[model samples]
Target: MKKTALLATAAALILSSMPLSASAAETAAYKLSIDNRTISFPDAQPYKLGSDVMLPLRQTAQALGLKVEYLPASKEAALYGPAGTAIVKSGSNQARLADGSPIEFGADAAVKSNRMFVPLSFFERALGLRTAVQEDTATAAIFTPEQTEAVVRAIVERLVAGEYQQLSDLYFDDTMKQSVPVEALKAGWEQTTATSGELTGTQVNQATSETPDQQQFVVQLSFAKAKAILSLNLNADNQVSGLWLKPIAEQAETPASLIEEEVIVGEGTKYPLPGTLTLPKGASGPLPAVVLVHGSGPNDRDETVGLAKPFRDLAWGLAEQGIAVLRYDKRTYVHGQSLTPDMLASFTVKDETIDDAVAAAKLLKADSRIDASKVYVVGHSLGGMLAPRIDADGGDFAGLAILAGSPRTLWEIIADQNAALIAAMDDGDPAKAANEALVAAEFEKALALAGLTDEEAKAQTVFGIPAYYFKEMDSRGADQIAAKLTKPVLVLQGEADVQVYADKDYVQWQEALKNNDKASFKLYPGLNHFFAKSADGKVEAQVVQDIADWINRP
Candidate 1:
């Protein structure tokens, strides 16, 4: 199959992708924080230079309570903290500590946009502060002498002791008090303990922050029946801002009747993907098979979201019914970190999902034990949206099953989702109007996608994603593609799903395929996006049975 320049630009809108440029100053890829509080850079944000975080000298030094002097003629900066005075030269990895001892940075300090940028390690090594960086989230945090792990430990102790009133009075800010009152906190704890059994113990897992003003501590709580996570949020002033307790669900055991074999999709190709092929044990004849494709983001073969492993459940459940199932890790999941900016610049849905899915389908057809004529493709979310295209792009499946997918363009659905969120917000909220205007602006950009040249699309970012990605998929609406297909299609939706609405998205699929007598649609009550009962990992057995019954029907 010939690959296109189009990539999963919609997925990039929600999932983390490599920045379009390698120049950290241009991309501002790293989020800087101090003492669990996010640090905002009004002019130049912190960026990653190799493994090191580069921060503007003056701003970072001020944030760290240090005095800084810059010598522009020689391009060097001297930082004065209580520990000592350190001198750093721009475009050099070598620096002198407060004690005049020579020190080296992981990467060279540089000047960008008239600002001298120094490695984050300078504060740690010269000023005697502690620092850590999370590469996955692109976050860098610095801890001062005033900030200690003991602070979060004390907060956890107060929570475990059930001193809601004291916690509220001493720790919670006015906003937090209104949002999570003492009574509310007590009731929440009671409800949690009642459902999850008494909290035997608690462990502070990690401390992090999303924004500049708020810090968060994730605490793991052990219960008699299950485990739960408590997210404790604090403001820069050390006041409690938010609190949430969610119980973790245990995963269902895989049945013994199923046999899983390790397989490779797109073998000997540029991007070979590892996959799992699940089949029923002791089956007598060639088995009907289906390939399971993922939605947005870098999903594992199991499509594990929180506790619900929907793809794994489907693969096991279907195998038990005498069908073989193929599920593979998404290409982005396997190779996203390794992809260069050039590779992602022209990358499209074909590169992210479709090509690998087609490869998996072909793999199934080659297996002698599998009945090639009965092979099908089951796509969830983004995968579902691109199912017909996958078929047109050489999947040539016996049938296609779409779960919780939209027939509308990806950007249209995103716009609708934002509009829905704005509608649900209080009219008096100051943020509501701002969000509305932002959505409107994004919608306008999305509208302009079709007219832009390839270079323009690649250069512009719409709705936080590369415009070219959307431009590539502009010609391939799921509904338009599905309308041209002669193969049978099964469209399943969860009525309660908030991400893809039943009335808006599912109904369109029904309308588009209405003339196809072989098309089937089913809506499950009280199910969410995963066709699971409230993300607890309990996928409706009926959903699996329905797909199996539909495929096996005469």
Candidate 2:
């Protein structure tokens, strides 16, 4: 029940009886704008002709600060603008500058109702203007040369000056207005400042136009705590269409005590996963090793989520403490899309997670640098829940480390998340009641999972996933499996974690393995899901030290 890929099949069934010109309305629905102002066409409006949005040349050119002149005898039109003069002949795909340089339109320019119409590209190629056609909204925006540089600079200045409301109100397009409202923009900037400290100054590195329609600016920001980069994108209408701000990651020198090697796990098998082996540089003897497993979703060997690389941290930190760590990319992460529907219908955790982990363990055992008998498995989140099963199915680890993992069923965890969301919703909110009903329906499907046979479970979906996936895991619950195992176990949890509750999941693991003297538990205060002090996502150094100490304990 972890995050699985949603396969979508789209079929276009065309009937002979259907009208060929059914899209005519959509073709003529385009609204043309110049310099952020919509142009009204008294004689000829914009229309699509063979994949190009054709606009009346006379009006469109004049709107873009160009003078239009027609030659009746030769059936040619001349557009004179600041850039140069362009000559276009009716029913021709080629245009020429006054200097006689020919430019291809990619489509023919034609005369309709006594008005010469040209493709949208003509404005960009011939007149040297920027243009964009938004197919979703059926609108095209054209920008004159004078509008690009000054507008981009002004936007950056206004943003750093904290003019979110004015930017949202005046410059934002319809899509940007909805996605990043004034409050959202303000909150994002505030969060950036909160992390990077006070905004000291700003420098605009460069403004570039990769495509004819969009202009991108890379700005360097100086903050009290850290320097960051802000990337701003603008549409042809000079609207703020996209924005991103991220702190520059600090570069740390690699420790000389540790060494790394590129290796492949499950080599010559069905899904060979590439991985990294971090080892103590000057080890005199075989060292104890740990195989790092990932949580839900397709994750790389680094287990990078946003900016955090917990697996890499563990590998490096533990190696610095004289412990070797092997981490590999998940199979689903590498081959999720290639897996067909038949493969997914019968897919379980063993195929998604356990098999790769066991392969990694076997790989460690075979390595000459590794101490085979002292090899351990460290699982995080979903990996944590399946640690016992991974050990049972040929991992044969000396110990197990479960980090931020729960003993509950995956569906039960999902149900808990949904219930918590419902509890937090306002009673009178319109979406609250509807979401409640939806959650209730999914809960019923989850409860009905155990009663159905494998064939029936595979046939029906619960919460948009095959019920058989959950049914398979239900029979081999991690708590039950770990309870029966006498292997040394270390359970670590973050007190501030909202995803898996300490009171419920952490307590349950302790209760399940209470009789085993080898079982140990530790809860971190003020740490979130990744066991970091703040949301910045780097795991606390003490946590790694604790793990290394536990592995090397006498």
Candidate 3:
């Protein structure tokens, strides 16, 4: 039982998988020694080790002479030539050919020079050919004529017999890639063995996306037994370029605590913008309540992704903690195409956020169980950023719990921040590849036009959008709204958050609230911007993901 097994000839039937170490067929591990000295900085990890073939896919595919056509209409690719054809769906395994039968193989397919290339071995197997893998060359030569015929014959025989729903030897191919070492996956496999079925399942769903050169399939398969989502990237060459297996249990829906009543915000002509209302169990009488505002984007109340729901967690967590929560879907989710960040400036303070929240607040205030004067605003992220404007008009809210709110005008803060990101570089110095002088010139030109009147601003470009409304944003600060405020303002910051650091917004609040000592500030030590704690809990980590359940709002 060696890791590499000889293909069954048209004469016999056998399926054998041996360990990589014991397999005589194993080639010395390939290391992408593209020194990348200038590109790979000293502090940078040399390379993402393992089977991430960073090499150009087009070069390899052309060497093999495969006809690669990335079909966008079906979101699957058709690859054929000297080797048999394979149909690759975005995010799924590479399809194989066994006469009328098909054998599937897993390897990543990516594009290069406007052409598709696949992982060497995967390309071979999908075409029913025998493969010779060479680590030093990071190449797998094909022996198609004899082996493919035999493979097709053997595969057909196996399908007829139904020996197994799928072939196994999954680890051997991975061992060669060296990206995610086999050890971690083995550990995960063993630890979740008992609970695998509940966590993972496989689906035949196919999705596709256009990369630089060719279109690719984004396939989503569930390893139900493992409770994981396995995403495969199949390029036009029918080779897999990316394979991601993420845990599924972490995505299960938490049963929401039953309370009383949920609300429906406007159903945009496009999608449902339903909202939820949570009340504490029992008791009675008017309770002090707060309206929950979402951050930027067309996020659902829960901000759904595959398995995590941060907003839902927040709403439910707070509701169970005694505070009533009212939150709704963002316009983006409701009216997908009608609204976008590009037109955000066109949306006045009221049409976008304020009016809906105020309407909800007013509605809540009318509710016999909610105290009108005691109503507060709990705004997260962009919600926190926009809170001052809403509070400026709401008049009735007693205070605001601003979470990760940015005090600086968004345009300036965002520009300075992007400048830093675009400036800093490490790998091949991930630094900005764009011409800085050009960008600076554009910036200066844009800002000069920023001084224009509203009508004039509409005529000039600022940050890819019109500059008219944006100039006003530069002069407007959160402190201005706070200056008019006469209530308790609790500024909440996650110490590890970089997006809206405690130093930036908190200090701004402290200085702005000097005359209004009623403004209180607290930092969540371990939390990121999302109030979630993690060493990696910075800008990217804080994105809200709502996945499943009877619970979250997304």
Candidate 4:
């Protein structure tokens, strides 16, 4: 299919998903308001259907400075605003946009006692507004663009301030109230704060739900004890229908055989990346060395994810097996926010992964304790996929070991990742189709980077990345490059890894390197993308031990 058609189809799939229903109540007890001013609905109050909040058409639109028109003969109601006009009729599930295109509503427009009631989602799309329902004072706050972030910030403040009673009373829905009582939630909050330490700061990213009227804000809170990502979803009534907090994995106890020393990659350069070097205590000179490389995202030497530190595990385990390991913090991890727009335009895999990786390898080679000819590269995920490229660029490595790598392009993996996540969710999950479209759109944007200049690339972004980044990464072929290399290759995969499936990514590696005598493959029975035993399990000892054995062999 053509790109445009593909995107359009994906978009339609996103819009067609209706929000899951909380209750089947036709009317709610909440009052309506806009911009802090209440609108008293005489004889009819705001109602809810599934995930949608329906309001009295004429008064709701007019209070927001929108011109409303109703043609009784045609049984149609229209809202006219600065951006566009929306036309909807009672009992209709489709709305006509300003461009006269039809968009499906999460719920049908309804009429009772000669008054039309329209879904808030309709106005959210056509008129670019936000709606929030608060049950405490029993008011629904219909707002404009500026209030979205502010609403989320206010809730976070309440959470941090320990105002549990007010917060629960103000925002929590029936499900939240029932599942987690006020006292229990407060205890959990206290425990989190006590365990994770005081909140240093928070970074927030917003996403609109498939219903459009609802919004979700992902807030990353930095604490002294741990870092956590909190996901908060607000319905049209501004009630927090869902909340999730995932804290970083706690670091495991230090190993006895390992001795750690701090080192810097590209030392004395503008990009001096700091890291840790792990070596077996009392080991003799000229030991085999492995430069540890991280996957995508800003990662520390440990390659910390949730509570698991796979890199640290590998480093410690390998050191126990008499190998030296060098692991460093990524460039983007330390100085990402400091980079300017122009700098990001020029940022590529070389700056992100390759150059530093090569530097680390050279650092390993220069060490008298590490055998110069026995230096190898161990890359995980994105790092794994690019290990061959790193080897080709910086020769003299003993071999390359890839863990949970994919032979496909980064964009393809991104699309697959989203699809897999959506598949894991319930079939009726409203966010599934919307997230899929978002991923598809991101890939489509990546496809356009080839013909763009530096300036153009700087102005355009895909998945929050500059087009130049994709342009550079897309040029290298991981499988093809690995196939051409003369060095021995070790491929490792986990059968239970949903992120990079064994059947697809591992199979690709096996097929691509089947003819090469030096290529070897190992598949773990129950490991995950991070080489963990289960969804939340720690890095398996066997996996790390096997890698140690592989590095030690001849």
Candidate 4 residues lying further than 4 Å off, grouped into runs, are 1-248, 251-253, 425-436, 447-456
Instruction: Encode model 2's per-residue lDDT on 163-279: one tens digit a residue.
Output: 976777677876576445454466567655666677788777545455555666777888787777777777766787667765665555558888889999999998999999999
Model 2 misplaced stretches (Cα beyond 4 Å)? 1-253
Rank list by lDDT: 2, 1, 4, 3
Q: Estimate TM-scores for all models.
A: 0.63, 0.59, 0.51, 0.59
By lDDT, who's the top model here? 2
Instruction: Find the 10 residues in a row with the least total lDDT in model 3.
Output: 12-21
Q: For candidate 1, what is the TM-score? A: 0.63
Whole-model Cα lDDT per candidate?
0.76, 0.77, 0.50, 0.74
Report lDDT (Cα) of residue 132, candidate 3.
43
Q: How many residue pairs clash in each candidate?
A: 6, 0, 40, 6
Q: Cα deviation of 513 in candidate 4 (Å)?
A: 1.8
Q: With candidate 2 superimposed using the best TM-score fit, by how many Å does residue 475's alpha carbon deviate from the native?
A: 1.7
Best by TM-score: 1
Candidates 1 and 2, the one with greater TM-score: 1
lDDT of 2 at 492: 96
**Model 1 agreement with the true structure over 230-264: per-residue lDDT tens digits:** 77766555566666666665765567787889998
**Residue pairs that clash (backbone atoms under 3 angstroms), model 1:** 6-348, 7-347, 7-348, 7-349, 8-348, 8-349
